[model samples]
Each structure stands twice: as C-alpha cells, then as structure tokens.
Target: MDTNLSNYLKKEQDKLNELLSAYLSKLSMPPLLNHSTKYSIEAGGKRLRPILMKLTCEGLNGDSEKVYPAAMALEMIHTYSLIHDDLPAMDNDTYRRGMLTNHKKFDEATAILAGDGLLTNSFHVISNAACYSDTEKVFLISKLASASGLEGMVAGQLMDMQAEKESISVEQLEEIHQLKTGRLLTFSIVTGAYLAGADSMILQKMERFGNLIGLIFQIQDDILDVIGDSEIMGKASGSDEDNQKSTYPSLLGLNGAIEHKNRYVKQAKNLLEEMELNGTLLEKLVDYLGSRNQ
Candidate 1:
C-alpha cells in the first residue's frame, strides 16, 4: 500500500473503533450480554463495511460525522452476522479474528443472544439517532432493513446453505453472493453516498459500483479461503470445502476466479473514474480490497 493510503486507512479505522466502543458502552444491556457482544466487537476484523461508508461519504464531500451512527449500526449488523455464522448450527467455526469463536468463548446460548442483541440494537441505534432528519432516518432504517433482511443478506445466506446440498451454475453462484455477502456491502456504499447528497444519477452509478465491489470482495474472500494461511486469516482456511460450501474457486478454478475478480475490479475502477473519484482514497480502497491477503 502507498504510505499515505495506509495512513489514511488506519486513521479512519481508529475513529470507527472509538465510535463502536462508545455506542456499545452507552447501551444498557445485561452485563453478560454486553460483555459477549463487546468481546466479538473488539475482536478486530478489517472493519471494511463501516470504513467504506465513511470513505464514500467523504469522497462526495459530505460531513462524514453525520454518517458515524449509521456506520456503527452497520458494523453491529456485520458482527452479529459473524457471530451467528460461526455457530454450531451454521459454519460451526472454532475461531474468528485470531481468537475463539463467540460460541466457544461464551456458551452457545449466550452467543446466540449476543448476536440477536447486536442485530436488534442496530436498528434501535439508527432509529434513535438524533443527527438525521425524520426523512433521513426513515430512509436509512428502511434501506438497512431491506439490505440485511429477507431481501438481502439473510436470503443470500439461505441460498448459500441450499447450494451446499446441490450443484449450482456460475450465474446461480453470482445471485447467491449478490444477496448473501453483497447486499450489506452495497448498503455501505449506497447509504454513504446518499448521505453525502449524491444526485440520483450518481447514486445509481454508485449502486452499480457498490455491487461490483461487493462481488470483488466476495470473490477475493473465496480465493483467500483457498490460499490463505489460517493464522493470518484468523480462521481455519479451507473450511469452505470442509463445510461443502460452493465457492468461486469450487465452481471456477483458482485462476478462473482470479480472472473473474479482476473483471469486477476493472468495472469498479471504471465506475470510480466515471464518478470522478478515480484518484481518491476510494479508488485506492478498490485496489487494496481486490488483492487483500486477510
């Protein structure tokens, strides 16, 4: 990474971490629930979704502060998903971010409740945020619900599980990811740009950019699962194959998956160029995420 881009990313991530901590500290939940939830939150993943939101908003010259609450809510939803995704009933993973999985750290029941609390409280945080106008709050809440709920990540996860049971075409695979992993990621970009006062045309283009970036991110993730080191990844690598999940490399060869990701990267970078964001930190993020090792 360029020194400046690396510094910028670190600075934004630090701010986001503080905001996440502040929000969690303010919520009055049962002590155990609070600890379990905070444990996962502090485990320290890339914080990619929230960082993307902040960058997108600033990239459009918006007051990035206005998007902080929404960004916090977004990370909460993502963390909750990870907690559930690691459960015995789901991926049954034993680790995350280089530590014990939530279910392993706490109990299964507590992990479940912690995940539930995070998901539910995410909406509460957004709805109660005083920074947004009523119209803005409604927009954020509704869009978030659609993106993370039945029409989005939840539905995609279901399809992914179902795909594990049978063969699926590449087109089918794309549809599954577009829902499962892509929706929330897209939500990050779209909501940030929306709050930044992007015009309708730019919003449409940003939506497309977000979708392409989502695909790029997932494709790289699948690649990482194949070639990544468990220690660096903070999880067991090749667990996708062990779990019988359909991955890009499973459907397409490793080289083929790389080609596919490159195609999306090209399209995403071009979209940035069209939006006049080609030389911004957002553009650097596209390259970083495309080839990220962890």
Candidate 2:
C-alpha cells in the first residue's frame, strides 16, 4: 500500500472510531444493549464504506466533514449487517476481525438487539447530523434504507440463503452480491457525490466506479477465503465453501478469479482516469484494494 493512502485512511478511520465511540457512549440505554452494540461496532477492521464516502466527498471538492455523519451511518449499517450475518440462522460464524462473533461474545438475543439498535440508530444519526440540511438528510436516509432493504443487501441475502439449498449459476451469484453488497457500496460513493452537488455526469461515473469496486471487493474476498490465512482474515478460511456458498473462485477457478479481479482493477483505473478528479488518493485506494493482503 502507498504510505500516503495508508496514512490518509488511518487518519479517517481514527476520526470515525472516535465519532462512533462518542455516539455510542451517549446512548442512554441498558448496559448490556450498549455493550453489545459497542462491541460489534468497535470490532477492529477497515471502515471501508465510510472511507469511500468521505473520499468521494473530497474528490468532488466537498467538505468531507459535511458527510461525516452519513459516513458514520454507513458504518453502522455495515456493522449491523455483519452482526446479523453471523447468527445461528445465518452463516453461523464464531469469529470476525480475529475476535469472537457478537453472538458468541454476548448472547444471541443481545446480538440480535444490538444489530437492530445499530440499524435503527443509523438513520437517526444521518438525519440528525448538524451540518446537512433536512432535505439532504432525508435523501441520505432514503438511499441507505433502500439499499439496505429488500431491494438491496437484505434481498441479496435472501437470494443467497435460498441458493444454498441447491447450486446457483455465476450470473445468479453476481446478482445476489450486486444487491447484498454492491448496492450499499454504490450508495456510499454516489451519496457523497449527490450531497456534494456534483453534476449528473460526475454522479453517473461514480455509480459505475462504485459498482465495479463492489464486484472487485466481493471477488477478492472469495479469493481470500480459498487461499487466505485465518490469522490474517480473522475468520476461518473456506467458510464459503464450508457453508456450500458459491463464490467467484468456486464459480471461476482460482486463476480465473484473479484474472477477473485484474480486469475490474483495470476498469477502475480507467474510470478514475476518465473522471480526472482527485486522482491521486482514488488511484492509491484502487491499487490498495487490488493488492491488500487482508
């Protein structure tokens, strides 16, 4: 990874961490509820969605701070999804980010509630942030909800679970991920551009970039699950395979998957070049995604 990109991402991650901690601390809820919610959100990992949002804002010459709450909300949604995804009825994983899964660390009920708390609080945070207008807040909330609801990640998860009953095609797998993971990722980038008041052309380009990045991310994750170390991924390798879930490497061979990843990486680079906006950080980010070890 480029030192500059690493440093920049670290700085933003730190700020997001502090903000999340502060917000959670202010919750006047039961101790268990607060603790469980805090545990999952504070689980150590890359705050990728929020970082993408903030970067989009900066690349558009918009103040990233203006979008901080939206970024924070995005993280909350992501954290909530991870919590739910690890439940017994779901993937049933016991570890994440090298730590016990929320349900294992806490109880299942608490974990469920914690996921709900995070999900519900996300909209509140976005709508209640001080910097953006009520109109902007409404738009932000709508986008998040839509992307998170039946039309987006949840819909994708539903398809994924159903597909596990049998086998699925590569195109079906792609569609599942496009909803389950890609939509929100796309929302992060496009929302920043929308809030920044960028032109329609700019927003369209960002949508394309976000979609490709989302696919690249999922593909890399599948590749990692096959070849990655548990110590590095902080989860069991081959969980997808173990769960009988389809993935890029499963559908395409390992080498083929790597080739697919490379193609998207190239497309992302070309997209950035075409956009010609704040190229340095974005370029480094795309490169980092392609090359990161974990």
lDDT of each: 0.90, 0.88
Clash tally, candidates in order: 0, 0
lDDT winner among the candidates? 1
C-alpha lDDT (0 to 100) for residue 216 of candidate 1: 94
Model 1 Cα lDDT, one tens digit per residue, 1-294: 867778987887888888778888987888998899999998867888888898899999999888888988999999999999889988788878889999999999999999999999998888888999989999999989999998899998888878889988999999999998788988999999999999999899989998998899999999999999878777778888887777899989999999999999999999999889999989999999899888
**What is the Å distance of residue 78 in model 2 from its true position?**
0.6
User: What is residue 130's positional error in candidate 1, in angstroms?
Assistant: 2.1
Off by over 4 Å in 2: none
- The sequence of per-residue lDDT tens digits that candidate 2 reaches over residues 1-294 is 788888998998899999999999998999999889989988848988888888888887887778789988999999999999999999888888989999999999999999999999999898789998989988898889999997899999889889888878888988998998999999999987887788999889999999988888889888998998888777788788887877888888899999999999999889888878535687778877876778
RMSD of 2: 1.2
- TM-score against native, each model: 0.97, 0.97
Error (Å) of candidate 2 at residue 84 is 0.6
Can you tell me which runs of candidate 1 are displaced by over 4 Å? none
Predicted structure 2: clash tally: 0
